[model samples]
Target: MSFKNYAFYDKIMLSKPVTVKGLTFISVVGITIQAYGKYGVFLWSTITPKALIVVDSSGDISFYQISNDTATSELLESITLLFAEE
Candidate 1:
């Protein structure tokens, strides 16, 4: 077999998803979002500045400062820092 075939076979062997320690963040401005997930219908619109939006699996649109936080204080602090710059 060629190198390409060997690589494909290796990927197929590890098709399961694994959890890695990390965080994910998405930022967008002046754009609308439509989210469809296992929860419900969620929508968001950002026509202003400092718009932090999060759409979960339940389809809920909420305005938040920080994206991922371990505690409420952390979230608040992040949000505070976020708008503090702009």
Candidate 2:
């Protein structure tokens, strides 16, 4: 028996997460999203610049922005989200 034989030593811990697909999201107001899956809709936020993204059955995607609590479609390639303070 040795220290290197410990069960915890068998696995390597990652300093950060690794994501090959979907998107990582975070925002102010204590919201943190690790991953967004494929298909269906992505409910962004209810605050300023409220946004929504819908993915159809065939993989067609759409982006929408909210104004006066109404959602309006927009053309977007990608979007960025803020991270919480460490």
Candidate 3:
């Protein structure tokens, strides 16, 4: 009697789904910044002339209207770090 080869009968398992909630949040914040720059530039500019339109080394543009408010400035810095290229 000859034995049949069962080596080809191995089951393939699919990979688990990855959760990108953090990435999604970052993306949303980035988009919000862009929109604010495009539409709310005038409003913010009037409130704070220290507005910044930064084009990083990667050519990514970000807008920030910073004031004497440390909390707001810190939050903006955190958002910038999030979208920064590694």
Candidate 4:
């Protein structure tokens, strides 16, 4: 589960469950109070040697690589801030 890029969010259609650290999550339309609802909004993310961990506003976490080729400039900036070396 190595990542080619870091983590961020964009609107993507997921047809199956994405597993991260043994946790599984499915995509949902709109926001919901449920714990596993919504996988589109990326609130925070971190990179590790094995995976890129992403957490949404709903507290749902997923592991996957973010596609840099399709990422927006704004999202790229945010991701830069998150991973910037101090």
Task: Tell me, by lDDT, which candidate is best.
Answer: 4
lDDT-better candidate, 2 vs 3: 3
4-75 per-residue lDDT for model 4 (tens digits): 333334332333457667556543221112122143332443222222445565677655544543334444
The digit string of per-residue lDDT tens for model 2 on 1-86 reads: 21221121111111232223553222212122232334443433222334444555455655445334332311121222112211
Q: How many clashes in each candidate?
A: 2, 0, 0, 0
lDDT of 4: 0.40
Q: Rate the local accuracy (lDDT) of all candidates.
A: 0.36, 0.30, 0.35, 0.40
Q: Which candidate would rank higher by TM-score, 1 or 4?
A: 1
Candidate 3 TM-score, C-alpha based: 0.20
Candidates 1 and 2 compared by lDDT, better number: 1
Which of candidates 1 and 4 reaches a greater lDDT? 4
User: Superposing all C-alpha atoms, what RMSD in Å does each candidate have to the true structure?
Assistant: 20.0, 18.9, 24.7, 17.2
What ranges in model 2 sit over 4 Å off? 1-49, 68-86
Query: Which pairs clash in the backbone of model 4?
Result: none
Q: Give me the candidate number with maximum TM-score.
A: 2
**Candidate 3 positional error at 3, Å:** 99
**Candidate numbers, best TM-score first, in rank order:** 2, 1, 4, 3
Which regions of candidate 1 deviate over 4 angstroms? 1-69
Task: For candidate 3, write residues 1-86 as lDDT tens digits.
Answer: 43332232221111222234322111112111111233233221112233344444454656555444435465556546655733
What would the TM-scores of all predictions be?
A: 0.22, 0.26, 0.20, 0.22
C-alpha RMSD in Å of predicted model 4 compared with the true structure: 17.2
